[model samples]
Target: MMKSLITTLLLITGISMAQPNHLPTSIPQTMSFQAMITDTLGNPITDGMHNFRFRIERPNPVQGGQVHVIWEETKQVAVVDGVISTVLGSVTPIGAMPFSNNFSLSVALGNEVISVSPLTSVPFAFNASRAMSANNATHADTAHFTHQAGHAHHADS
Candidate 1:
């Protein structure tokens, strides 16, 4: 029987403050994926290492507009108490995959295709990268500065 699926993909950007002078030049190319492996009867699978295949896809404009697979890889993940927590792109870098566009993910546990989820939101860090590219100005225009005079009056006055 097919296993029940509860899957999540969260893109996390870790800013290192320990080395404030050495900030990262680029956002990380990985995301955290978690799923609960359960049987059809809602029982957790036995805790152990399991093999899973993952694919990142987008809608293809060519070939009559089918889903296009951009990346795929197999990974061995450790499942504890029916929960599998793993970081995607650990084996291979998902470098510059253009998460700015619509994308979806598909997964297969062992030999069974388990779930497909839509990637509806892009991480805030990704948007920061877009802002950097959108700017063309080297200096601030219409800049202004002002100074105000200050006076103190006596309490009695």
Candidate 2:
């Protein structure tokens, strides 16, 4: 019993001397926010099906801080108030090169989607007030987005 007690005390003291309580040393990491949206049948969604039109001003890159990466199904997409949508944006958090299932991102547009025009699929209007006024509106096409990899980002208001 005395031998076991002494060994246990030594082990605890050793661990206390060696272990760290804080997060790992900070690195200038760039977080990538990526999403792979799929259909109900689990097929990859093409850019042709979406209109991306949202405006965002990214945070000034911090020294030694990981950059945030963002990706979404639409920069701008239709929103209807009374509608329940199954459309979800798949996400990958910052610094993850090969995206996995550790993160997911999702948002809703509005109330009722009476129609979606094939010609104009993008949902974000530069005119925020007017876009909100209209029960339904159009926005930037998803294919038009110039994604800068490794840039951290989120919605602008």
Candidate 3:
């Protein structure tokens, strides 16, 4: 009987440990978010349809440490075997907003909300913003030179 009990306990522990704790380490260019959902009892919530709200928020507020929501959207999602995959920018564009600091993710389902998850990697969109700023600066420099050339007319000669 003790042997049987030990086996049962081991199986339960293994199942509970299988749940994913962090987001993917690689930053995806397409803004796809994937997660595994489980209940408080560590049982996977699978084969269900649910409404999920996702939000990206600044970790530290400009005034205080209070979080500020930068982007949010609600979507009807399908869960298959405890895994959920959704493209974030599909419903609402994440846009070219600058991410100066690492942001946290908040997910709301039903009345329960989880807001402690920090993004594992910097967003691809953040790098894109830097690239755009560099391009704009280059164009501004060229425009300044062009303006100077136009003003350099021959002085009455």
Better of 1 and 3 by TM-score: 1
For model 1 the local lDDT of residue 147 reads 11
The most accurate candidate by lDDT is: 1
Prediction 1 global C-alpha lDDT: 0.72
Cα RMSDs, all models: 16.5, 21.3, 19.7
Q: Model 3: per-residue lDDT, tens digit, 17-90? A: 99776445444434878888888887878677999998888856566788888888888889898889999878
State the lDDT at 17 in candidate 1: 38
Q: Report the error of model 2 at residue 98, Å.
A: 25
Which residue segments of model 1 deviate by more than 4 Å?
1-20, 122-130, 134-157
Please tell me which predicted candidate would have the highest TM-score against the true structure.
1
Q: In angstroms, give how far residue 3 of model 3 lies from its true place.
A: 66
Candidate 3, overall lDDT?
Answer: 0.71
lDDT tens readout by residue for model 2, 1-157: 9999999999999999898654455432332223444545766544433443211112234745332334434434332332223323322213322222222233323332222211121255346335334432233233122132222234121
Question: Between 2 and 3, whose lDDT is larger?
Answer: 3
